[model samples]
Target: MGMLNTLLQAVSSAPIGGAIGAGIAAIGAGIGIGMIGKSACESIARQPEAASDIRGSMILTAAFIEGVCLFAVIAGLLAVLK
Candidate 1:
Protein backbone atom coordinates (compact mmCIF):
# COMPACT_ATOMS: atom_id res chain seq x y z
CA MET A 1 0.00 0.00 0.00
CA GLY A 2 2.76 2.45 0.79
CA MET A 3 4.63 1.67 -2.40
CA LEU A 4 1.50 2.09 -4.44
CA ASN A 5 0.81 5.45 -2.86
CA THR A 6 4.34 6.60 -3.56
CA LEU A 7 4.04 5.54 -7.21
CA LEU A 8 0.79 7.41 -7.57
CA GLN A 9 2.28 10.51 -6.08
CA ALA A 10 5.24 10.40 -8.41
CA VAL A 11 3.02 10.05 -11.44
CA SER A 12 0.78 12.90 -10.37
CA SER A 13 3.67 15.23 -9.61
CA ALA A 14 5.47 14.70 -12.93
CA PRO A 15 4.95 17.12 -15.85
CA ILE A 16 6.72 14.86 -18.37
CA GLY A 17 3.50 13.16 -19.41
CA GLY A 18 2.23 16.33 -20.99
CA ALA A 19 5.47 16.76 -22.89
CA ILE A 20 5.24 13.18 -24.11
CA GLY A 21 1.70 13.82 -25.25
CA ALA A 22 2.86 16.84 -27.25
CA GLY A 23 5.63 14.80 -28.87
CA ILE A 24 3.21 12.06 -29.82
CA ALA A 25 0.89 14.63 -31.35
CA ALA A 26 3.72 16.07 -33.41
CA ILE A 27 4.73 12.60 -34.61
CA GLY A 28 1.16 11.85 -35.61
CA ALA A 29 1.03 15.09 -37.57
CA GLY A 30 4.22 14.20 -39.41
CA ILE A 31 2.81 10.79 -40.32
CA GLY A 32 -0.44 12.37 -41.49
CA ILE A 33 1.40 14.83 -43.71
CA GLY A 34 3.62 12.11 -45.10
CA MET A 35 0.62 10.00 -46.04
CA ILE A 36 -0.97 12.94 -47.83
CA GLY A 37 2.22 13.59 -49.76
CA LYS A 38 2.58 9.94 -50.68
CA SER A 39 -0.99 9.70 -51.90
CA ALA A 40 -0.62 12.89 -53.89
CA CYS A 41 2.49 11.61 -55.57
CA GLU A 42 0.85 8.33 -56.45
CA SER A 43 -2.22 10.13 -57.77
CA ILE A 44 -0.10 12.47 -59.87
CA ALA A 45 1.76 9.48 -61.26
CA ARG A 46 -1.47 7.80 -62.28
CA GLN A 47 -3.03 10.97 -63.67
CA PRO A 48 -0.41 13.35 -64.91
CA GLU A 49 -2.91 15.96 -66.08
CA ALA A 50 -4.52 16.29 -62.64
CA ALA A 51 -1.21 16.80 -60.82
CA SER A 52 -2.04 20.42 -59.96
CA ASP A 53 -5.41 19.53 -58.49
CA ILE A 54 -4.03 16.65 -56.48
CA ARG A 55 -1.19 18.77 -55.18
CA GLY A 56 -3.56 21.53 -54.09
CA SER A 57 -5.83 19.11 -52.26
CA MET A 58 -2.87 17.45 -50.56
CA ILE A 59 -1.57 20.81 -49.35
CA LEU A 60 -4.98 21.72 -47.94
CA THR A 61 -5.29 18.41 -46.11
CA ALA A 62 -1.78 18.69 -44.67
CA ALA A 63 -2.56 22.20 -43.45
CA PHE A 64 -5.65 20.97 -41.64
CA ILE A 65 -3.66 18.18 -39.98
CA GLU A 66 -1.02 20.69 -38.92
CA GLY A 67 -3.68 22.93 -37.40
CA VAL A 68 -5.06 20.04 -35.41
CA CYS A 69 -1.57 19.16 -34.22
CA LEU A 70 -1.00 22.75 -33.16
CA PHE A 71 -4.15 22.61 -31.09
CA ALA A 72 -3.07 19.32 -29.51
CA VAL A 73 0.34 20.73 -28.64
CA ILE A 74 -1.27 23.77 -27.06
CA ALA A 75 -3.59 21.56 -25.05
CA GLY A 76 -0.66 19.50 -23.85
CA LEU A 77 1.19 22.63 -22.80
CA LEU A 78 -1.86 23.83 -20.91
CA ALA A 79 -2.01 20.52 -19.12
CA VAL A 80 1.62 20.85 -18.10
CA LEU A 81 0.98 24.34 -16.80
CA LYS A 82 -1.91 23.13 -14.72
Candidate 2:
Protein backbone atom coordinates (compact mmCIF):
# COMPACT_ATOMS: atom_id res chain seq x y z
CA MET A 1 0.00 0.00 0.00
CA GLY A 2 2.87 2.34 0.70
CA MET A 3 4.41 1.69 -2.69
CA LEU A 4 1.12 2.28 -4.43
CA ASN A 5 0.60 5.57 -2.59
CA THR A 6 4.13 6.69 -3.48
CA LEU A 7 3.59 5.87 -7.13
CA LEU A 8 0.31 7.72 -7.28
CA GLN A 9 1.81 10.78 -5.62
CA ALA A 10 4.74 10.76 -8.00
CA VAL A 11 2.43 10.69 -10.99
CA SER A 12 0.30 13.52 -9.64
CA SER A 13 3.33 15.72 -8.96
CA ALA A 14 5.25 15.08 -12.15
CA PRO A 15 6.02 18.08 -14.37
CA ILE A 16 6.14 17.89 -18.17
CA GLY A 17 4.06 14.71 -18.12
CA GLY A 18 1.27 16.48 -19.97
CA ALA A 19 3.67 17.84 -22.53
CA ILE A 20 5.15 14.39 -22.92
CA GLY A 21 1.70 13.01 -23.55
CA ALA A 22 1.01 15.67 -26.17
CA GLY A 23 4.31 15.01 -27.88
CA ILE A 24 3.50 11.31 -28.05
CA ALA A 25 0.12 12.09 -29.61
CA ALA A 26 1.80 14.37 -32.14
CA ILE A 27 4.26 11.63 -32.99
CA GLY A 28 1.42 9.24 -33.68
CA ALA A 29 -0.24 11.80 -35.96
CA GLY A 30 3.02 12.34 -37.81
CA ILE A 31 3.40 8.62 -38.36
CA GLY A 32 -0.17 8.34 -39.60
CA ILE A 33 0.36 11.15 -42.14
CA GLY A 34 3.64 9.62 -43.27
CA MET A 35 1.99 6.27 -43.88
CA ILE A 36 -0.83 7.93 -45.83
CA GLY A 37 1.68 9.74 -48.01
CA LYS A 38 3.65 6.55 -48.62
CA SER A 39 0.59 4.62 -49.63
CA ALA A 40 -0.62 7.40 -51.90
CA CYS A 41 2.75 7.57 -53.62
CA GLU A 42 2.82 3.83 -54.14
CA SER A 43 -0.68 3.87 -55.56
CA ILE A 44 0.19 6.68 -57.91
CA ALA A 45 3.33 4.93 -59.05
CA ARG A 46 1.45 1.72 -59.76
CA GLN A 47 -1.25 3.56 -61.70
CA PRO A 48 0.09 6.71 -63.25
CA GLU A 49 -3.23 7.49 -64.92
CA ALA A 50 -5.02 7.56 -61.56
CA ALA A 51 -2.50 9.81 -59.87
CA SER A 52 -4.95 12.71 -59.70
CA ASP A 53 -7.62 10.67 -57.96
CA ILE A 54 -5.10 9.26 -55.52
CA ARG A 55 -3.82 12.72 -54.71
CA GLY A 56 -7.29 14.07 -54.04
CA SER A 57 -8.10 11.21 -51.70
CA MET A 58 -4.78 11.51 -49.99
CA ILE A 59 -5.29 15.22 -49.33
CA LEU A 60 -8.71 14.59 -47.82
CA THR A 61 -7.37 11.87 -45.54
CA ALA A 62 -4.39 13.97 -44.50
CA ALA A 63 -6.65 16.92 -43.72
CA PHE A 64 -8.79 14.80 -41.42
CA ILE A 65 -5.72 13.53 -39.59
CA GLU A 66 -4.41 17.05 -39.24
CA GLY A 67 -7.75 18.25 -37.85
CA VAL A 68 -7.70 15.55 -35.19
CA CYS A 69 -4.13 16.45 -34.28
CA LEU A 70 -5.01 20.10 -34.02
CA PHE A 71 -7.95 19.30 -31.77
CA ALA A 72 -5.73 17.22 -29.52
CA VAL A 73 -3.19 20.03 -29.28
CA ILE A 74 -5.89 22.53 -28.34
CA ALA A 75 -7.28 20.15 -25.74
CA GLY A 76 -3.83 19.61 -24.29
CA LEU A 77 -3.26 23.34 -24.10
CA LEU A 78 -6.56 23.85 -22.35
CA ALA A 79 -5.74 21.11 -19.89
CA VAL A 80 -2.38 22.63 -19.06
CA LEU A 81 -3.80 26.12 -18.77
CA LYS A 82 -6.47 24.96 -16.39
Question: Which candidate comes out best when scored by TM-score?
Answer: 1
Q: List, residue by residue over 1-82, the lDDT tens digit for candidate 1.
A: 9999999988786567888899999999999999999999999999999999998999999999999999989988987887
Q: lDDT of model 1 at residue 79?
A: 73
Off by over 4 Å in 2: 1-15
Candidate 1 regions with alpha-carbon error over 4 angstroms: 1-11
What would the per-residue lDDT of candidate 2 be over residues 40-66, giving only the tens digit for each residue? 999999999999999999999999999
Clashes of each: 0, 0
lDDT of each: 0.91, 0.84
lDDT of 1: 0.91
